[model samples]
Target: MHAQHDIVIVGGGLVGASLAIALENSGLDVAMVEAAPPGALPPVFDERNLSLAEASCHALQALKIWPLLQTASPIRRIHASRVGDFGRVSLDASEVGREAFGHVVIARDFGEALEKRLGDVASLTRYRPARFIDTQGLADGRREVRVADAEGEHRITTRLLVGADGMKSAVRSSLGIDATRHDYGQTLFVSRVRPQRPPDGTAWERLGPHGPTAFLPRFDRHYGVVHGVPSEEADAVAALDEAAWLARLQDAFGWRAGRFVASGERSRYPAVRVVAERLTAPRAVLLGNAAQSIHPIGAQGFNLGLRDALTLVEEITAHGLDDAAMLESYAARRSEDRARTLAFSDGMARASSNEGLAMRGLRSLGMAALANVPGLRAQVVAGGMGYRGDVPAMCRENAQ
Candidate 1:
């Protein structure tokens, strides 16, 4: 059977689902193709902690997804310091005329919230447990896509095709788009730990020779910890017992959040940077990890991807998706934000891992500047809260 839609999104993960839901009132017929079965969490949703920027929260609020989140810990303050360094930077949301910089939510919980919100989108048709096979451009400027399911192969025709299929995107390959990959050579381990003092709305970052170790506040009174180790030591670190792992984390992170008493299951993710050569091709476009995937050093991966989704929604609502001009405009609008964010994440990953004396001095100076200069610090805060470049309406104040 053949299906027709204004748009067919080929991934129902975080960014893809958010895009589909944000277009709920756009009066467009949309179809979402997800590889995961109904009621099952997507691979992207794991035990990792996600730091949602304030702007991201606003966008989710506008989509009516934020209210469905059962547990989220607000990040009222952020503290950053390096091992064996005297320079430190502390930022409080109140200093910037905001209640909080952002909130932290577990990836699994956020995925559940997205799944719930997606079910309520009246205009969206979902194809769960379906795999995208291939696509071809049609004579009428639309594209025909083949999807595989248990029943058989089905064809879908759409004015616009979205490749939110993530790092290894079939749609991107079919569109003949090339992407560059950069390996950071670091493995990040994430889990929850019960700290003696508990989390008090403070997010801490302790940078070391290997990578950054972050402690984010969680609603359950447990601290969400991310410890990064060199890629060569990943297996050894992962093999550590609970007691040994906790001890290592404490050693790297210091005693700011107090000693970690109890720990939970651990998850490790290899750090790699993936950026598509371009963001759009013909009637197809890329979103989230399909377009670019950066290091999680600043917890900017999902937040940046969400912005990409919301921005595309705005463009689609303003200008119909029938023309190549609309996609070109979308790509141009995303250029600056994408470049800056990619640079920031990649630079942080490299800088923190460099143990050379010159790099260490530069890091110390940078921290001092961020701690002392109000203007510089404000810029950092703005970027941290996801307010850089052209802000999307859904992420702006009083949106919706």
Candidate 2:
């Protein structure tokens, strides 16, 4: 006989874990299956930095997960420019009537914080170091999921099966959901650097011929670095020594922030945009990277995923988890938000990479216009701060 659960979350990373936490005390039997060890950091957060939008902060606060997090540096301003070009734009948080645009935190820190709260939720059952082997859809709106852990294999029948798994989601594969993938032909090198004139709660994005390089404020006067380069040149770029790498970065980004004085270990990932054609099918659903993996140029990856988790919780709580009509409503509500975010991120990546004179001039003009127009600037700030369209109820709760 298979154990039954109200919901079975197939991934235990940020998005999956957030869903489990959001469902706590809702009188539902929930289980999270994670392939990684309980306390070990997942590869997704190994060295990435997260620019948590204001909406994300609100959602985290509602879940009571924000208090456990530390090392978040507030962003008061944003500076955008194209290297060796005339286009420039600056966005101030004060203009938007907010304390700061957003907060930057190490991805690992977020995972650690989530780990601390996971055990506190008495109603959430977690199977660490477990893998989702397969799934079988039943006729009565439930799915039988096979999970393998150290002890042995376990079968779970769940009214709702959420695939929070990453790009290569086994759950999504089992359901045969097709994704439209677009490769940007670029790779991003990420690390930390100490700028001589350290960022004062400001995030900077410098677009160049290769791609965009972002400097997000970090704790202890350091800036989290995300430098994009051609995929063909990634190995060569990574081969450079610390000093040489810093020199290359300076050459690309100019002296906008300041001289780079120190450095840390670096990581790189390919730039790609992947959107699953369908988010929901029968009793299963996809969230986070599994639903849509967009380019990280705009820092919308995790913010978008968190919205997925929060909104799903809202729908499931409003109607019982087994309500097929409610599940359809959940999918409909998410369609607009997901489409807009994916397009924005995909468009940003393309605009930053195209170096044609016409494209460059257009980008410059758009940036300048956005900087000067109050309405346009406000929209950019709002979107950048993760206020893109209707989101979770918690995000709007006490929203500034």
Q: Write the per-residue lDDT of candidate 2 for residues 275-334, one digit (tens) a residue.
A: 899998788899999999888877888999999988888898898876778778888888
- The reply for model 2, stretches above 4 Å from the true place, is none
- Model 2, residue 332: displacement in angstroms? 1.2
State the RMSD for candidate 1. Answer: 1.3
Candidates in order have lDDT scores of: 0.91, 0.87
Q: lDDT winner among the candidates?
A: 1
